[model samples]
Target: MTRVISILFWLSLAAVLAFITLPLLVVVAASFSPTATVTFQPFEWTFRWYGDLLSNRWLDPFLTSLKIATVVAATSGVLGLLAAYCIVYERLPGSDVLMSYLLSPLSVPQIVKGVAIVLFLSMIGFQGFLGTPALIAAHVVLALPFVTRMVATSLANFDANLDRAAQILGAGKLQRIRHVLLPMIKPGVLSGVTFAFIISFNNIPLSVFLVRPGDSTLPITVINYLEYSLDPVMAAVNVASMAFILVVIFLFEKIGGFSAQIHGGSK
Candidate 1:
């Protein structure tokens, strides 16, 4: 029975992987196809569609998305670190309640949040913030919970003895936090920041409501283009976006010493 279960687990894992990967493979292939119709034959593949991505039509939205995602990632990282430190490390009164409020956004549907934000903005007569500013704020709200939870988990698993040793050696609270706590939690912080960047970059439901006439995100632009035509350039755009995301993750992993941490944990 155990052997049978093991076989079933492997089969299920393979099926799940194939489900996730097959569509990406199709997109990559379609990006290289010579025409709108996706072709599997390499001889028919061309880089012409990729060349179209250089135009302002695509570049403007890509830049907008990049800017928003970068700002969201940085803001979420810093705010999450502070919130997690206060709630987890300090354990102040009503910490649980504060955490619940911080994570409340996650439980709400993103579309509902988007609608609410729009209504709130209109009511407050600040509709001027409906473009990039709105996008950044909404993304931060969506991402803050994930960042806070990851950092909190890291803090909870932290070795208290290290802080205590630092205290004994005449290190102050700020110094211990800067040297010991921050370094130990760096992995979780980076992971949260990376997640924030990806989600903000690819977000559509929320962005659809917030985007203005001249300022739109890449995902929104891709969707609007799809509404008019079925173009291979869309596939090329997706491929490039995926490549950019991979590069971002690689850079973050290097900065956070993720590989070293993994090796150390294994040992």
Candidate 2:
């Protein structure tokens, strides 16, 4: 009876997951709809929306988002990794307090952060937003906390003996890291990069605040398209965006073995 119940529970969960992902499936299904009203049936199909996405307006923002997200992920990943290393391995003065402060942004509302950034920039007569760089800054800020926490968690189980062993073996600091330390915490570094990149890419709040005209990211482009009309094209765009996201995650997993990082298990 217990085994039967467990199987039933798992089946129910699988059904629930399928239900939740139905919208994405529907969006993909509708992207090829022939009519203006997108439906999931034996309907007319066409790839016109995919063709429309080729225009510079859509193409530009997609490129901008990619560039910004890449830079932000790199910046936040390195900074967060460094901070995690210091907090976990180094006995720096006031390290605990500093870690708390660095991670404090996670507690603050995104709206508050955006407003604060906007205000600060405005006060300084710095109006460089609505471009790739501003989005990079926003993505960096948004992703920093997640990267720091992920790296820190990996660090928690780290062995101090590894560092001692490296030093005793006459390995220098860079060599110790390259040869001994990095391989052990490789999962954390990979996790930090994935978490940072995904969170930054999906974030809309900070992007909305900082984005300037002609410099909109993909989400902003979606909103702008929605404001002008309600068409099945929206569904197609949604599906394309989803595909883009899945591609990024798939590549991350392919390159770094995403499961180990996320599940805290051995490779």
Top lDDT hit: 1
lDDT on C-alpha atoms for all candidate structures = 0.91, 0.80
Worst 10 residues of 1 by lDDT: 258-267
Give every collision pair in model 1. Answer: none
- Write the residue-wise lDDT of candidate 1 on 26-141 in tens digits: 88888888777765555576899889999999999999999999999999999999999999999989999999999999999999999999999999999999999999999999
Tens-digit per-residue lDDT, 63-174, candidate 2: 8777778888899989998999888777589988988988999998888888888888888888865467777877788889889888787777777688899899899999
In terms of TM-score, the best-performing candidate is: 1
Q: How accurate is candidate 1 locally (lDDT)?
A: 0.91
- TM-scores, in order shown? 0.91, 0.88
